[model samples]
Target chain A: MIDLSTFLKEMISLPGLSGYESPVREPIARTWQPLVDELSVSKLGSLHGLRRANVKGDHHSVLIATHMDAIGLMVAGLDDGLLRVMSIGGLDLRILVGQMVTVHGKRELPGILQMIPDRLQDKSKAGSPPGITDLFIDTGLPINEVSDLVKLGDLVSFATPPQEMSGGALAGHSLDNRASVAALTLCLEEIRKFNLAWDVWAVATTQEEETLVGARTSAYEIKPDIAVVVDVTFAKGPGVTDYHTFAAGKGPTIGVGSNMHPALGKYFKTLADEMDLPYAMEYMPKSSGTDAMAIQVSEEGIPCAVLGIPLRYMHTPLEMVVLKDIQRTGRLLARFITQLETDTMEKIFGERKA
Target chain B: MKELIQKLCEISGPSGYENNIREAIKKEVTPYADSIEVDPLGNLMVRKGKKTEGGLRILISAHMDEIGVIVTHVEKTGFVRFGNLGAAFPWYLPASRVLFLNGTRGVINSEPREDNTKVSTIDQSYIDVGASSPEDCPVKIGDVGVFERPFMDMGTRVASKAMDNRSSCAVLIETLRQLKKSPHELVFLFSVQEEVGIRGAVTASYAIDPDLGIAVDVTSVGDTPSAKQMEVGLGKGAAIKIRDSGMLCDPRVVRWMRETAEKASIPHQMEILRQGSTDAYVIQTSRSGVPTGAISIPCRYVHSPSEVVDVKDLESSVQLLLKLIGGPVQLK
Candidate 1:
């Protein structure tokens, strides 16, 4: 069995930015290899780990999706020697000024994000954060040497290593869905203690942050009767305290939104309540911004429910999550999967007898 | 007030993504407000003061939303092409840091041009988080990013991004914290989506349907070098709105504000803003037409990343509100 903290740290260290999830996918596939019966990779680079059901009748599969991509930057051009970059996900420019990054050029090069000095910039804009143009990657190597190593369209990722904070909190980049990925792994491990009836397709989806391509396509191919999307949500911390963000370490968030089926969400909420696990229902008025959005609309439509692990400083290099929440989320999901009956599909989306 | 403003300014709540800001305001005002409720569109409407029978009902509004950028496309090379969510100036965006609600941080930069011509539009610019390829980028198309500058206490003045309305929210929060009693029913509205199209204020004002509406928002000043010739100036007290680019202030509402400021001896200046409007404009047109006016905070660099506001002006705006609504609305 893999240690949760060690697994999460290794996941964060991998460079699996959207569309480019191969680097991270390799380890995920390896981790899922022993637990799943059949393993396959999607055309768009999504990883599929299938746990077959033991039932004698027709098989019903449940797709569990957690996006594996991390937000990062791409080299747009090289000016003099420094790389001109662009955002791959939602980048907070304020945190970019002094952030350390790794430029994946011909070879991995260590660099510091160099913001144009306040003295050289206009007074009106001085001390004000500069745009990406006014910023460049300083590799410390000579200009010609830097030019030789870096190329246009190279990838740059936050190089901040994972930190184990006080309490049971873990902080690092790519925790958004990677933490959820860890949760899915724990769910698979939990299922080993029970004989489940429904097939479980643990999918490490691609491009959820950039596009729902991985979820949309994977769901269509697998055609699961139900889908449970696990992802990280905002945790109450400095500067973020609203209904949209839940408290970290308290519990996971069950999503209620356009993408979530009412019955499906209610079941998860009831399950959490039944087990005395801490959970909150996040209201998504429109798009849930998860793989469930894609899975819900796939083909004839599948009932989807989103489960979120509370994360602090999401998307930044220092995104933090409580290991307890990940374990709790995994336990709840495992219990829910084991409780699924043959008529569970009818319970989720069948017509009522009025 | 400074601490409150700083706290509010740091929260990232772009249009359609105001839950974080809404939560901050809700927590602060929960103890003082009579009842607090969030509308379907994510508007935090707080009812305060005393409920008087047939007495005046005044609504004080401040938008909680800020200008942002929505990722439109992510290039194969991992550069994210984006569209402006509100009125984020292209020139100001270059070298500015933007953050997604999830904390994905990236800097906005224009694509290099061989001709050395600066990229003037949003399309020519992209967000850089240093991903090497499309697969390497963590951002997806349609993810929203807002300015992520920190609050700075510049002695007498404070500077920060999203202060355009977060500062106003601080004013409303402070007003709620200070006001002990009121003769009229006061509905303090912390609205959303103001930066995009004043969407939240419109829906919120329609629901309240108050007799009078007053919006507290930051207004631009011509205080900088060779700036446009505008009457509003930073540190010159609150700018009492006469009219702006959005709506003409109700003459009666304007008169009411002016006399109240004078009687209370609150420092204020008459403002004839030639551009931009506030939540007041939308509220003024809600229901059977509300007599709406705005108390403008004279701010330099209205929508830029580093918005400057005089702390004195923030205090005066709070005093003026406390004087006007701490008692009955006497608009005769």
Candidate 2:
């Protein structure tokens, strides 16, 4: 089996911004190749790995979609020896100052996201945090060399390497979703030991950060009987202990909301309880802000459930997650799939009807 | 039609918690619909006409959700701190009444501030549900509620909370009730969660994959005192939307709606709303892409407790929709 921490570290190291996911897709496909029966890429660039059912006589399938895309910056314009950038996803501008980044130009060059000094900034804006237009990616090259190597529309990703923290936690950029991808990968690996009765599609979706295009198209194509969208949720951390945030290093969260199918959410909660797994019931009263949002409404609508791994400092380069949460999420998914019979739909719908 | 609009407007269905309104709408459309089903996202889809060879699939959508609030925290004193479910403005919340889905009522008020200070944000306000202590509180986290206001009839106009959308729902329902026959297949969709992000229509359109789509909703009017400049106003007939912030109506669909209204001699006006959008925004981009437009009822004070729409506009909207969907919809 592949190591979860190492796989996640490798994923976060790559540059796979929304709509540009080939770099991360390669490693995911390589890892999932030997674990499933078939592997294919959707036209919209989502990685789909199908682990066929061991039981015969036409069974249902479940799509486990985890977005592999990461939030990053793109070169929107070129300044004198510096690059003007625009964010590809939701980024907190306050956290971008002094952050290390890799400018994916003609050659991979290291850069730093730097804000203009207060002395040189507009008088009224001096005390305020700089906006995207006020920031620049400064590579240590001359203007001629910088212009030669970098072009407009080049992608820039966080260069922060994954760091192991106290209590078996890991920190890095793109862990918002890469952690979920590692969990789904762990589920795929663990399910190999079970004689599964339903086909399991482990899909590494793209463009979840910007558009849900990847999950939307993949769900329409796969049309799974049920979809389990695994993604990261906010972990309770410094000054951020709110109702929406869960604790890290505990267990995964089973989402309960409009985006989630109530019966499927209950099934996961029941399974977690039976297995003595610690979990939280996260309430996402509106949109779950996951692939489940799109998948739930795809092509006549598929019953959807969302599993969340709590990570701190979400969408930042130093986002952190406890490794145990990933493992627990993976274990829960494996157990659920292994326990799914051919009549699991009936059981779920029965619960719904009741 | 007025009674149906009043009934729908009074129901307590926020963006995500739309079960009550969905049930209410199902009861209204069941007798007229050939097949009625609710999608996973709580969108009520009713199939009225059958599909024939080469017949166009037309999806007529009216969102059932209204902008409201979700309880995020219950204070120690039993006051509820909440978040906006859609676009619940903090300015509109002060001194307003809210009713939770569980039948708990509360009055929204801001913390005491010196005179001339303003409550410009939601965090500065809380809902007093009359629970003196946390233990006595009836509303908990994740509970949703909408503005509690009675629907009012003002001769040619109606005023109520959720009139922004329930008025449109009434129009769609009336269109379904009065239409005798049509060559094209019609799917009347009462979508959920449109105020949040036009979410319900995205999936419903993909499922229906209609050749043409039209959304009937309320649009802001400029006739209000010092309102934002717009070409739409109450009592001006059905507003054939040309563009909004989210989507520009397809020329073909726009032309079809305008031409149909002209031929039927239905009162109509061209609308160019600079702010806000409708379900047609997402429906136009569903799947391989659908040519979509919106028929907006001119509304005053939208997203407030007292949204007013002229009854003449609602009737005209229903008539226009009937004429558009009444025959074979040829886009060419």
Candidate 3:
């Protein structure tokens, strides 16, 4: 049995916000290095780990991607020792306020996320809402020293550490995806013990929050015959009515829609149902908003699918994820990749049997 | 070269639905091809060499599709309500021209009665198919529509609709024409439905069982005014893919293309597209393993009513591909 929470805690301790993801990059890459065959970085900063299956003619290449990058802020301009910032990826302003952050300056400095009071919020003046200009981070440093140390484009990340809750749940800063990365790490570890066919490339994709660029470049590096993107999706809660049928504490979610290949979607759903693992379905009409969108269209186009862990308060400092979901998802991917051979895999999109 | 480019541009092959364009491309390449076949999904694969030899099996794919719209609903007042087949900026929709797959023409008109703010919101726009009633509408749901042809010469830049990828299709065509006897087992797969999801390449690459695949397509150029400060430039030459939002070209293959271009003195640049993906990504990872790369013809205003490209760049891409095909297939 894998101690998933322990690994999640270590991952959450690292502040890897989007473009400034150096802190978590090398550590996570090193974690999975012994389990994988070849580990390298693409032209982009995506960390790719390859594990070749022992079977001969198991020449199939499969990529399982989970972006290591997370949403946070970049120091655009310093104002009076306070950091004026830009959101590197999608930052829900509603959740960002009153959160703790770490300002990555010449050195890592602790900071608090704050905004002007509601009087300045101007609720009536709607449409596009307030820009990042309205929000500022206070690091408690002198203006002269702050300006000298922190220049524009300094990365800022949430300062939250991963913690286990009573009901098999974990809360952290980047549970939106780092939890998925942890799951991929578990998959890497488990596959090492088994003698499987096919080459599995476990990728900790970068820049997925900013853009799906990391998966794009990394997919090219792995050049897998089949690709699977693991990420997180919306978990329903109060005030979040416009969402999918996914719930927190569920095992995992399999994407099914136009963007998702029907065969791959059905295949995952069937496996989840047969294995008796709790799973839900989500519609990915155009783009899954995961690395799947990037991986699905790699050279000659990789037949792609997505496996997501339901997450609540996504893109927030206190992003929440369930523990069992990670373990189950990783197991499912390990089994799927191990079972893959050229013959059985070619039936990926072929007609179903009676 | 000019005639080939003109013919490729004139043909329409919208994403997810490409039949006529594949037929047209098949007729053109059939003479030089050893065996020609179109898959069930409509991907046209033209093979020129034998599978007997242990020579490299390479798939040179060019998407025969362009971005367009599908008629989702037809209003009672003879207007067609539609949605985009791929990513489309509404700024390019209103007052622009479109053509249906069945040769029926339509004009995209903004809802004049509504506020200008909602013009691009899909509901505030409809296609005018020159019909007075819903019964008179020639098109129906599932029918694909693409931008109407608009070819022009603006100084050195040639402007046209669907140049987003048709320019590269022309490049692929010219490159094949230049190679009378390919040195390797070549699969010239004129892929269908690329503007949508690169649907054609997915099927074609599987059938060819290619050891290496190269997607010839269009990339973004920064030479345009206020463009995203891209290192790639128009007329500078063809672009060897290093990294893009799709797939990264095999480093050894990229080095080979660059070396081939530089040694032959064919002007070429390396592209680093951040937000967009290409067919190379799908081809690169197909089946078990196949080394894949892309050579893109840089174009301006991708997926818009009017796209622009430099003919000099198109010729350079063709020339570089010619060098690759004419010589031995080498993989590092």
Candidate 4:
């Protein structure tokens, strides 16, 4: 049996941010190379792994996608040894100040995002954080030495490592997505033994944090019959109400609504119930702003579904995830792939589906 | 080009109701069309390219609809209330001239307020359509009204109502009119209800699943005062859209259009609109597969009754489309 937690830890330790994803991409390709029947990648850096079945045309060609990119910052400008930074993705300015980060400049250097204090009185003003212009990174070196190591547009990432807490929870950066990639890798490990009859595609998508470009290009290139996206959803936490967030410590979330195919969503729910696995029915009510959004509209619409692992502090440096929830998501996806068939695909959607 | 665009901007077509502009486009396209068809949803499909061998189904789309208001109720004293169709900023609607779909002109009046008084809203404002009383009203509930149509020539810049997209539709018609023999079978689709929610392209894409699609729309220009600092601007020529907030356009199609413009030496610029969307959202992922891109006429004050654009840009768009279609079918 593969240790899924170990794989997730390895993935979360690396910092492959929005545009600079080659670090995570190379290691992921190495792990997925031997698991699929065919390997193809998009110019935008989407890695797809396929495994065809022993029986001919018995399985419906299906694509399971998980994005591997994380959100970070770039050195917009430099002042003294402290570099002024701009976030590449959405950043909650409240937690950004005083956070330690790894500066991927000409060479890797350690830095910290800090702010200058003004003698303003109101706490309201303090609570309302300043723009990127107000944030800067302190590189312990002198101005001349720092200038030699760091240049403009150099990527900077949070310096938190994957830490396992006592309550089956793992904390680190990029768990919003990298953990999903780890779950995908575990699914590939189980799928090698199953003699299912269908073309199974496992894609480690890129740049999902910034835009839907990777999924957009990959969906066009592969043009699969059905698509299932795996990503993270915000979980219940302190000061959190039901309106803004869902319950944490729950199992994976099964999305149902207009954009997601209703049948495919119901299929996953039924499968989870039959297996007695923990799951929840969440309604996106519209096109989900994940990889599923790009996949559903590709090539006359694909019957797509999203399975989410409950995560905490999404889009932050130290996001939280349950270790067992990862295993559950892996097993459920592997089961879906092993059971994929052409008749099932046609039945879920009308015969118009290719 | 300036005169033609001026004529097009003077027309009006709001979402879910575009008959007046539909009939006007029919007149323009009828002369050049071997056949033309208008669906029940009010989308006009004009077919040209009198060739038989290409087997190509290419859709050239430009939305005919613009932002406007729908009369929700009529209060006493002939004060008509309304709701906006698209992103008409609440602050930009106080004193603008509005016209009903049936050619009834009115003024959007905000009630006078003291410094201590609250500002009025869409629900509070009234359309003075010169009606004597509620019983004498010609424009009632459910009637659509827009900024009164006007085409003004300010030196080289032309400003008119519904130019957000009507400029593109006119260019499509002009391109079809100027074609000798298009190698690819062209479907000049005057899509409807784009401002509401891209309602027409959703069905049109199903009807004509093309090998390739090009959405002719308007992209934001950075040269405007206090505008977001993007590179593309008015009078620079055709603007090739790379990506917008709503869609990630095909990279191959983006490269193809850029190269086409460069090869023909047509002055053009690249656009990355941080906000809003275009018909390209449906064109890229419509049927089976379609490589999609957009050529925009850089226009200012979009969504307002009077959107200002350059006639030079319109001519540049026509030349670029002509070179792309009739010249040589090149694929990257």
| Error at A78, model 1, angstroms | 0.3
**Per-residue lDDT for A84 in model 3?**
70
A249-347 per-residue lDDT for model 3 (tens digits): 778888886667788888888777878888888787778888888778777677788888888888878888888889989888877776676665657
lDDT of 4 by residue, B1-332 (tens): 77777776677778888888888889988999978998878889988874457446678899898889999888777788889887776666778889887878888877775652455777767788887678878799999977875688886678887788888987898898888877678888999999888888868876877777889999778788876545568999898876666754565677788889998899987776767788887765464446678899999988776788888888889988887777545555
lDDT of each: 0.85, 0.87, 0.78, 0.80
DockQ of each: 0.01, 0.03, 0.04, 0.07
Number of backbone collisions per candidate, in order? 43, 0, 14, 2
- My TM-score estimates for the predictions, one after another, are 0.53, 0.56, 0.59, 0.76
Identify the runs in model 3 with alpha carbons over 4 angstroms from their true place: A1-354, B51-54, B117-119, B180-182, B328-332
Measured with C-alpha atoms, the lDDT of residue A284 in candidate 1 is: 90
Candidate maximizing TM-score: 4
Q: Candidate 4, overall lDDT?
A: 0.80
Task: Residues B189-271, candidate 3: write the lDDT tens digits.
Answer: 88877777777787787778777878988888767777663557888888887656454456568778888988999998777
What fraction of the real A-B contacts shows up in model 3? 0.00
Alpha carbon lDDT at B118, candidate 2: 68
- Report model 4's TM-score to 2 decimal places: 0.76
State the displacement of the C-alpha of residue B224, model 2, in Å, after optimal TM-score superposition: 35
Residue clash pairs of candidate 4: A59-A197, A59-A198
Docking class of 2: incorrect
Q: Pick the DockQ winner.
A: 4
After superposition, the stretches of candidate 1 with alpha carbons farther than 4 Å from their true spots are A352-354, B1-332
For candidate 4 chain B, the 10 contiguous residues with the lowest summed lDDT are: B110-119
Top-down DockQ ranking: 4, 3, 2, 1
